[model samples]
Target: MAHYARRRCRSACAGKEVSLMKKVHVIGGGLAGPEAALQAAAAGCEVTLYEMRPHRSTEAHQTSDFAELVCSNSLKSESENTAPWLLKQEMRRAGSFLLKEADATAVPAGHALAVDRVEFSRRVAEAIAANPRITVVREEVISLDESGDHITVLATGPLTSPALAAELQRLTGSDQLAFYDSIAPIVDASSIDMEKVYFAARWDKGTADYINCPFTKEEYDTFLDALLTSEKVELKEWEKGQYFEACLPIDELARRGRDTLRFGPMKPAGLTNPKTGRWPYACVQLRQENLRADSYNLVGFQNHIKYGDQAKVLRLIPGLENAKFLRYGQIHRNTYINSPAVLNGTLQLKAHPSIVIAGQLSGVEGYTESIAGGLLGGRFAALLARGEEPVAPPRQSAHGSLLHYITHAEAKHFQPANITFDLLVPLEEELRKKIRDKKERHRLQCERALEAWGAWLAQSALPVG
Candidate 1:
């Protein structure tokens, strides 16, 4: 750790005039941007937060609220010793503003850290409004200010405006990588047929928070056939690319094989049918979407099929035969830069430390991962504003490993990733061979990560929560 810090000291531009500024300009008001503004403010840097919304909206967003969560309400698992949990733990230790809002507005979705997105966004907006150090600007940033005295953090996320994207491409002299991200449909709660579906969480771990749609083998076959024949929303020539496998549209998944949906999102492994007293042939889980509990989204059911075809195919599931959809599954262009070719370990441009790139734009995926990027990027910006060398988190921590993966991955094959045990620094060979239990190995990794994270936070030159 000391060696890495010393290495950083040798190249850091602490004495340069650019690092002496007290101002920070953050573009975008999505999950990562607002968090960056708050963290920079907390570190005593004056922040100008820009959000071009309502007046200039994107394809997927519906509201102008800061930190609006569009894709899904669930923020992944909260089960202890899991990768997501480890990341959130580190964020809590650092006093992340968005995470706090998520906690306050949480609604039941079994063991996952789900929230009422509307309430959560409102709370974050309130925090930004009340903070004296943050000045909100409602407008688009179409061009880069290369000569500004203040440092800039670009966090425009997946749907970055075309002009800003072009400016970034021009600045870096590299074409930003792009992907297709799909979102699932939200169903009206009252329209679901209670008689056909049952309420249960997988393995009956605790309170039943999800509504499970069970299927017999015949039913599953019928649905798959309809899905295979459905009309889909075709991608334009420029917008075409294979989607991230993790978020593949259901029909795209079905094309893999007849049984693909049976094991993928529609898998029935742990969910037991109360009426039959056995597991169904297949199942589709519905997660709560908000605090009101009046709506639920099809879990892992993201699709790009035409809206009418989507309704027809999805309704073939037993309980959804008469279900009313509040929102149909849709796909959007998800844009991001190739981090290894563009960003440093501190998530700043290699040639320009004054410019930091975070959020989905920085190539980290998922809700928590985006916030983690913002948290770290904001702190680094704060350090630079104070004319200090910005330090990267210890590699053992979730924050460190995630940043490391994105910044160190091979440029040609780099893809945005969620926090997973595979991304973390592994245990020594001897330790791995000695402990064969997968769960125990994971626990040890989590323990080691948190300890290192704590030491780094305490020992940083300028500490940030």
Candidate 2:
């Protein structure tokens, strides 16, 4: 069996030599961690993938499955020429194991890549189990001290265990290491009022993949009042902190001002109500939950309010008046390190080069962003094991932009980031002036990034497959 597995791995790597492989310890079996392990294994490193589930559990996860998505099923936009699309495209080109699994388990979600959570997790577990160079261990990793000689990739994600988190605090010498993130609610598809809500993607970009609940001025005001007066879940003393700006709960955003939500998530721009034949005062969009179309998630409707009050407030939306919620919005602690103070662009800790961090814990936000980190960290760990220098993708690329932001952003003001064009290096001044359209500029940037990424992949010691 061992010999056959080695032959399979060697065949996958195009018959590359696997003699004298070094051990790679990956802490956590979430999206980034497993991707790192797979990439390392593909690069000829022996990997032990650790997951502390079933034996132990966290607030967000409900299952023991590897790479179980705790929040939304969507992996964000798949629209071409966009930053998220570009990042996923690069990962697919580089043979990201998780992305391949995602594609295999994908559900119809307009232009966004959504998946059946259960199937996705199952496939990830199956793939990890079948890999010869990767070993799965269902045990809690409580300390970085355990990884003495082997290369360690910390992809434990935002819901890292307390013991491991404490150890990390001790290692990094920083106490402010955690933040809060929220999850949106999901509703049964049969509960939506088809007459009240119209199906359409924003700006007609993709297939009419979203169910928009258009609101009149009076309905918007009533809903806002309910949201403001809704009973909220009290935060524990230790869980208190400013919420990450990117994942702010609905109530938190409402606290800023009455019009804040109208301008933010609930904005009606680019969406016209079929009944009224004009833009409504505001709208709440519901995205498909799974391939079966049994449920839909309230896009950008995350809140920390009590479930009862949440139901009451949410039902005030135009089409959700009869909505049967499959899951209520909840908030959880999302712990992440201050990466700029500790991590290099290659995702290695400055104080300890052997220790690499990836995923949400590494301070990059969004699903695709976490996978990108893991891919890089795993590849770098494999290269280091082979005594080769790890090369980062070009700064012009989305991968490099995300790495640069995490490692070089102002430490005092450091926060997690989702992939955005702003993070990538701006186009040349001459070109920018010549091409004044923002979309056109982004197109050029994507073109340049793909070119650089291909060149980097060719030169790097990591395996392309």
Candidate 3:
């Protein structure tokens, strides 16, 4: 399937006369940047991919590699007929370079498409470097001139450099919206109490890849109290208190309510505890960090607490009492624009059509969604460079649903979104009534989405496998 997609992409560009003047300047070496560059190059545009890494670094990245994953290695779920899975399927059909690289470096993550971060980045960088039409420049792009001849894709992601971010603020005439994004801590797998933590994927959907720490009512209560009282990393006066709802700090989750954690991350709805043969009061899941399985990340336990306090509070979990921390949870600023106010459905800037925005900086969250933005932004930029009208994916498709959400969401309450069934256009009234079951409705939605996506690909200039 992947090979066919690549062949189609190459065929789409074959014999096309690419104007030397119609170059695509892609900023950032992150997931979106590389994807954008690859797509543009595949569309017969000369692409200059700029990376600040090795010359400049961000708060989260530890390497100079392209598309280095900072927060988590997992790219959410790969469960079939789900929104995320549907989006990935579309990317696969469209020949998303990053998605193919992710597949090549996948680790054992049950139904989730998790990859080895180092290898994933390495493969992405290698591919970008090998592309003849794509030239990688290692330097920071501090400002963008909207009047420049080249089409620019601003895919700097959430950790865009301050100078560039400020320039973007001036260009959009609105300060970038920001929120605290937290990273989950990773622990040495050997330190965990194997007897206390059992392996199970929720509902046994796939091979048991998750390490589940079951908690009794008393144990959960004790842990909650400790988390609530633990000292947190103090934010600067200016960085005081906004957080993305999807990736809230564990400490903040505890502050919401004692049961919030139980209902959110620690929910024990699925999988019977091997020891008790029933659901526990609560549970903490640990996902393997890499293919080696030497480390496991505290799933959805992103926090900004002091290191000492974090260790103390986390060890309260049943299996991690003597856990050895591989990496401590930390918080960083996630910068994004008010997409509804600044972007169009094609991801082109409202004020300057020459500049396109992609990734988290464009207000879509999650790894695959960011890549989706890059896919569209690159394609749109290519079409514009070729003096052709840019087309959006079908509204019923995951790609179009995400693009629509970012560009048409209520500007007053705009927040970044991950692809969810709620974001897609609702099912027809008759279908909804006939299919009363929610999962069945979603399955039908996925079916409609793929059908619409197939028609869109067939009609549009986009490469189809």
Q: How much does candidate 3 score in TM-score?
A: 0.94
Query: For residues 28-141, what per-residue lDDT tens digits would candidate 3 score against the true structure?
Result: 888899999999888888999999989889888888889988888889889988899999998888888899999999988889999988889989989998999998899999
Give the CA lDDT, 0 to 100, for residue 54 in model 3: 90
Which stretches of candidate 2 lie above 4 Å from their native place? 1-19, 146-148
**The candidate that achieves the highest lDDT relative to the unseen native structure:** 1
Question: Across residues 254-308, which tens digit of lDDT does each residue of candidate 1 receive?
Answer: 9999888888999898899989999999999999999999999998898889999
Question: What lDDT score goes with residue 207 in model 1?
Answer: 65
TM-scores, each model vs. reference: 0.94, 0.94, 0.94
The lDDT per prediction is 0.88, 0.88, 0.88
Model 2, 417-463: lDDT tens per residue? 99999999999999998999998999999999999899999988678
- Model 1, residue 206: distance off in Å is 4.4
Clashing pairs in 1: 94-465
